[model samples]
Target: MNALVPLPVLLPLCATGLSLAFGTRLKQFQRFISVAVLTAVLGLSVALMIAADMNGPLSVHLGDFAPPLGITLVADRLSGLMLTVSSAVTLCVLVYSLGQGMADRDEETPVAVFHPAYLILVAGVSCTFLAGDLVNLYVGFEIMLVASFVLLTLGGTGPRIRAGSTYVIISLFSSMLFLTAIAMTYAATGTANFAQLAGRLAELPLGVQTLIQGMLLTVFAIKAAVFPLAAWLPDSYPTAPAPVTAVFAGLLTKVGVYCMLRTETLLFPGNRLGDLLMAAALASMVVGILGAVAQTDLKRLLSFTLISHIGYMVFGIGLATREAYGGAIVYVVHHITVQTTLFLVAGLIERRGGTTELTRLGGIAKAAPVLAVLFFVPAMNLAGIPPLSGFIGKLGLMRAGVADGSVWAWILVIGSTATSLLTLYVMAKVWNLAFWRAAPPGQAADGTVLESDDDSDDDTDEGPDRMPGTGDEGVRPRHEPAGRAVAATLHGHAVTTTTRLPRLMTWATAATVALGLAYTVFAGPLTAYTDRSAAELIARVPYVEAVLGR
Candidate 1:
């Protein structure tokens, strides 16, 4: 009878259907509807969290059919907490995108269509978090993949199209692998319900159980962008528009990590795979940060850092103790907020400076002092500065690692520290290049070239500058006609250019910065909640009982 409670999932689903039906002709209406739907969903998710906290775990079967025969949406402490955080993040990103005028950019003009796809993506994520069965989780994954495919390609640029292709291919392959894993799980246990599988899986032969665990890990690793399968992430993430990049960075990969945490902790506990996971995690941290240091583009550098930080969470998972898992949970929440804020600030820098390429930009702090602070806080936080949420999270994780006392755990601890230092270096590189260097001669106030001038002799070369007339002329400059300059000066005067954040965009950046600060100040309460959620997840029995009515 619990099936009656469907609005939390259904609200977003209905919004998606509405947008698809009337998105183009009534663009404003679509935006209004999308925001309204998501706001309601956010409230519902919060209520769900409060309810779960009050009442242990809650489950609602679909179609009035019992689990093992039908689908179910289960909300325990972990899923409930995840849903609340994810909904809040998505809502903020949606508002930020609107404020940034993303919907109006020619590239995202069809972003009228984006409302529908975005809602569907949120729905999919919710479903994934709430799913009680492996098959249902697979369906949730497919839903998100399909929606993300459209979001990734929204701008229709050559790079976006190319990136979209890679994203889709990787996603589809992962889905197929997930499906295969689900088939194996069902075959082994005769039921896809998570609780049922957990009980049955524990009784299976050790060899068969390991095989199942390997398959599931492979599928989730691809999703989480863990080492050796993480190439698709940096290439694909940087190509999207800012808000989309923010949400994708904030929420998507973490879903994979969530799946991994649940699988290892619940369905296949006591497997002694901690050493293998620790090795993979160490590689992810070192390699990802190294890649970050080598990147000159702001977005690309952040993408590398994102992959690197995923290692810290995985490291916590590998430790497999209550304290370690608690740290991992806190890190997950902290990373989501901090990462999204960083990306959004980077977008603001791009909009104000006219490019994200470090070589082409300089001295933006003079023009956008507020923007400088906005970028600096989270950059430092991501680098694990004291008093910030990032440092608190890393400290928690390192403490847990030391407590575990395994050699591999110690290796992870050292690697994570090194990764944090490298992260600071990369962030500093961006700060110095983008906000500290003097503006180049003949550059506009925002460090952009005001006009193309073949003969100015004032184009300050920063990184790899391209010289004009490199063909047969061979380093010789071609003379511009005297008359051309006079005519161009007259025509160019009418074009007005400015370099400051719009009021709305300024507020959007401020809001995200505020979010980071809030996380920092409220770390104690948040960590306490995360610890409770971790405990519930490890216990597993209440989650099972709620879903199966046993």
Candidate 2:
């Protein structure tokens, strides 16, 4: 089982080279390589999860070198669980992207580049989960970010390039901070390995420990998009292609949260900054949802909610107890599935309705009932409706908060509850506007715009000079009328709206939706697993021994 630790990281990387070698010359084979590799990874991850749960942590030393010198990978129960969930989500999203490429005549995803980039992204994510030292973790992040930049600017369209630029800048800044943190850690403690840091950091002076912890937390916080640092997300995500946005939303920020969970528990056992974490959680919950409430675009709306719900996991972490950690882990798993499913469904809605702008969408319930159901289940799940996995996770966290009985905990309980209500309201608004309301005038019941209304341009927020569909970078003619602008927009919408929702895409989304429901069905055993994982993480002994053989 120890040998299995490196396979998840290695398989995708090897497959990546094969994918690139095939390139556009063998598109089908490239797609096959990606799907098969991810499928293998998912299987391996599940096996690792069970093995780690039953047998403690699993560790592998590359080049036969021991820890503190050679690179090491460890898969404890928490990392194993994350690996399983992330691999499953990535595989589903890959299938969805393939379907998208086929539907678009290979225009959207560009199979050649997308396959290798996505494989690299998957390998990077797996590496981070399995990394035993700070330096390996940094390498993993760099690999992931580089691939993400490629994915984000796939078409080289003006909007995508702009959004990708913002994303790249923020990501690079965070990477610099991460490097500084690693350097400081090694300088102070003589080793950057987690197990070594566990014993050594505790011996440092109080001020030095505080400075290092604060710096590391800042770096992870920026990656995680906690409030005050999250302004880049909504702007960066909505412009990408659907599958790119979906996978990023599902896995990336959670990587940051995972790092926080690992470091806080293993390296800073006492939670010296518990109150500070709680305060950030409170602000994230409140500010993030408020931003969501103001969004009219579906993707941007989901982006804000993503930041808001992250607060729930952080809330659990701030409590710093076994039960709290268990709850946080459960919420992380649930959020990853539900959030990815919602974004995929959002893509479907965009395909059917022609745009993500709610004002222009309507009657989807009547036009395409299956899409409606697909959107509704996950949307409700996201809102924490009863009996769903979302509710189960939130309830666990709240219960843990109450048990803590601290004043900050009480405040978080109130804040989280309010955030849940706001989330429900936001989902409901989207449903009413996009799925339930009568189709806009000149738009048919099927969501096709038969003719452009002269006044339609007035309803939109885009200015005449910045018409929505004009991809050219230059300014529009000064004399262009608003009605003419509206006509051009209709033409652009027709191209997307007329596309038949491909069978493969629909099936992939349904598969993801089913995965979210599976969590609800298996809540008991899942919570039990997370509880045990939390115990091991808090104890930190199993992982240390597994890596150092001490």
Candidate 3:
């Protein structure tokens, strides 16, 4: 049972090795193995959560070495909860990828690259959550860095390579800053052990403590895509495969947020960066959403909103109250599932209409009501509509801010409300243009109609459930192009529907959406868990004691 803490990290790494050794021949086996590994991890995560909540922090020292000497993996209430949610999210994304036939033999992306890299990404995320020291956290980040870079540039396509380059440069820059911060932390405290730092850091001069805090937070802020540093994300994420984009949007940035939350609560408890965090939170909310409102591409818009909602989590951290932290925790959990589903749905929208551009897409509701419904539920939840998890999370933060009753808190209260309204506007804009409005001329009028080559930024064509408008019975050639031949062939004999959005992909997306709804259905229990987790994280004593065995 104590071993479950490290299994999440180990399972994925082991899977990565096996997938690589299989060398693409056992594609089906690799797929099933990956799924089974993640399922086990999820079950173990749930068990860890139960044990952590009951037994306090559970620590497993590597090679029987103690903290500050050997590496340690700790599963406290907060880490365990994060592990469970992230595992479930990653598992769904893996299934979604399989549904897309990504693992099939493809010239562009070798099976060797995709499956193993994906499993490595999972291990990296798990490593970050369970890390017990600063150096271990850095290692986790590096694992993620390597895996994500490969995943981002998989096809060597133009936009993907461009996005991948920018992602690499920025990630390298952040890694350097993080390394520098770790050096300073070790130089100052003589230890990288998180438990030991809690006491040692408190005794440092206020100026030194503040400097270290600033440096560490800066690195994490960049990683989290928290405004100013967030510019790379909107472009970088939208260029990848749909499943890749979905997992990136959902998990990677939140790891950064998770780090920030931990450092603020544990190491630098009263060191005073609250005001700065509050200012950053407000700017992120306003700036990110405004950017979203101006976006034409569906993926890009969701990327900007991802930045906007991050402000809510930062808001809670800045307030540093138990209720506020609780609210932020709930919000983080809500956003991960919601944001991932939105991206996955964006993939489906493109597959259905052959484009995610608002200008090109229309009549989705009339043609594929199922896809429309999939998009609608999450869109409203993201907009903070009443009775959803998003609304519940926002209400929690607003109440916390109101209770704090400071000038900044009041400003944040108003700001949060405004951000929520703007989020609604953005979601409504997507719905209006992509689903409600008619398709523009020279474009696909209905989901079944053929999309022009211009519709895809990458020149990829997707099969919709319906066919081109010229057919007598709503049928058209599966791979028809927008050329003289296609023009000449219009109004010919009816063709069979060629739907490319696979059943596994749709079912995977639906499962994730259901998980998002699960949050709302079990809101009370989830809220209670967050509340307790927040309080325990703030306490910090149990963590230190568990590590030191005192």
Over 1-550, each residue of candidate 1 has an lDDT whose tens digit, in order, gives 2442356568889988888787777767887988898888788887888788788888888886877888888887788778878888888888877765532232334566678889989998998888888998899888888989888877465667788899999999999899999898888889999988878999988898998898999899999989888999999988787778888998999999999998998898884688888898999999999999998888888999999999999998889888888889888888888899888887777666655667656777776799899999989989999999899889999999999888998889999999999999999999999888764432333333333323353655432222222222222122211111111111111111137575665676677678778878998888888888888878888888887676
Each prediction's TM-score versus the true structure:
0.89, 0.91, 0.91
The per-prediction CA RMSD against the true structure, in angstroms, equals 7.0, 6.1, 5.3
Residue pairs with backbone atoms closer than 3 Å in model 3 (clashes): 448-466, 448-467
The alpha-carbon deviation from the true structure for residue 124 of candidate 3, after best TM-score superposition, in angstroms, is 0.4
Of the candidates numbered 2 and 3, which has the greater lDDT value? 2
TM-score, structure 1 vs. true: 0.89
lDDT of each: 0.78, 0.85, 0.83
Q: Arrange candidates, best lDDT first.
A: 2, 3, 1
- The residue pairs that clash in candidate 1, if any, are none
lDDT of 1 at 485: 14
Worst 10 residues of 3 by lDDT: 487-496
